[model samples]
Target: MSRSLFDVAQSIASVERSEIRRTTGRIARSRQTCCKIMNGSGSPPLHRQGMDYGESKDVQKVHAAIQREKQEPRVGLEPLSLWLIGIYALAVFFGGAYLGRFSGSFSGDSLDPGTVPTKSHGPGPGGGGQQQTAELSPAERGKKVFMSNCAVCHQASGLGSQSQGYPPLAGSEITNGGSRRAAMVVMKGLQGPVTVKGQKYGSAVMQLWESLGDLKVADVLTYERQEWGNHGGPVTKEQIAAFRKELASHPGSFTEADLEPVPADANLPGGEEGAAPPKPGEQAKPGAPPQGSVPPATPGAQPPKP
Candidate 1:
């Protein structure tokens, strides 16, 4: 508790003690009456009844604090909510903009210079598989779809990290594609060394993410497939689950031949996709670079000192 609150409690306890009450009573009643009469009312008495003032200004301070607490907004998010939102927001925001720039050739079209998925080009070929449910946030509903399946090797970002022999998602060929094609790929994991956004990404067979139910898997796949510039179209949870059901007979990972790129103008991959490759001729900043290698673009991007 705050020091002021502690002091107020202490003062209240003291006042309740027999000795303190006796002491206050011993004070000249005539003098106490004179002070109250001078003020026209016994405000000090009323204040003590509510809360005792150990110091002269404590009563006002306590009342002010109560008033301030009452004035605060009731609908504000908690710290955890703020953090989850912040991380997801940053993933979509920075990740979207970053991915938009490296879309092979279609990078900036849908994710152009702003947030919010751009307009659609019309229902895709398999439009029946496009319906999505409103039950959960794209991320929340997508979690189950992602966990039982997606967490296998690509881990999360869909980009799979190099340390784990997976590619990065900040820029990935798969994330930079269309919906139908991406959904199919989700149902069937990827394989081989592939070229994403003009860069080569070689790898072993990846696990299939088709284990989730259609809506659950579809929504999640759609979310990951679309976010970060892999535009494509909406992958219904039903679509994903159905594919998983179909593939139940053979339980092995998929190869590169299993995937196909979505069409262009389909907003296939929606945004720019890629970590800004460090600029050439740029030096690392003072605190940049782990151990020994220099950081790219940390220098020279700054304007010359005035």
Candidate 2:
């Protein structure tokens, strides 16, 4: 009975040893699978694994980027085309030819041969034997003179202040009057009542401009006659000179009564020419009325039909 019990105990100890070995093998396999899933490899601890491009999405993209960076970029100069080379060569040849033909010792005078080479005369009045030319016309010069001298009282527009006794030159009968009367007024001056353009003006004293030269006085008169719708024609320096001689004895200022009467057949230029008379049988064509002239109004005239 004692021998049988000892044999049973030995058999039980062998079975336990086999069971422990099987459990240890299963634990080792489980640890290997866990390491592979967590670390992306199943290599031994502390031993580096070869890079597996297909192992992970992130590793594959990184490897591709590195490979692209390592490749050298293509760079080189290409020779110019045959047509372009020929064009450049032609431009160079033409440019050289142009420079050689027109250089003119680099003095830059080859193109302008007509230019004066020497300074023979300075640019001034009567220089180079040329007559001194007046830049302003007589009327234009007279306009400047009137603005500076007469415009203060008469005004630039020549419409004087009637209330202040400054007479209007524009549309004035005195302006269109004969040059003799006009010249006398300017040289010797005038005073008291003066009717200009039908407006009665008085108590104003016009100072004499006797010191003004013949040309200046003549220009002023001419400007006054021609401007402001007063077409009395031009006044000449010769006319002013003759008038000055005639008025040599007259020293004092004149009144409105002293001036000569403007006749119907005045000697002024631009006067109406004699029109042809009506024939024996036919009615004559009516002449155009004179400028600034008004016909007498009938007592009870009806309005003309439009």
Candidate of highest lDDT: 2
What lDDT is obtained when candidate 2 is compared to the true structure?
A: 0.70
Q: What lDDT would candidate 1 get against the real structure?
A: 0.55
Question: Model 1, 1-306: lDDT tens per residue?
Answer: 698899999988876897867777878775787788678766544444443342355677767655654344466653467888889998899888876776656743432212233334447774544444333444454555555556666676566655555665544555555444555556666667655566566675565655444656555755565555554345544444454555678556555554543353233222322232233345556765443345576655885598
lDDT minimum window of 10 residues, candidate 2? 268-277
Give me the candidate number with maximum TM-score.
2
lDDT of 2 by residue, 7-30 (tens): 999999999999999999999998
The list of candidate 1 runs beyond 4 A from truth reads 1-135, 147-152, 155-159, 226-232, 241-253, 258-306
In model 1, what lDDT does residue 250 have?
A: 53
Clashing pairs in 2: none
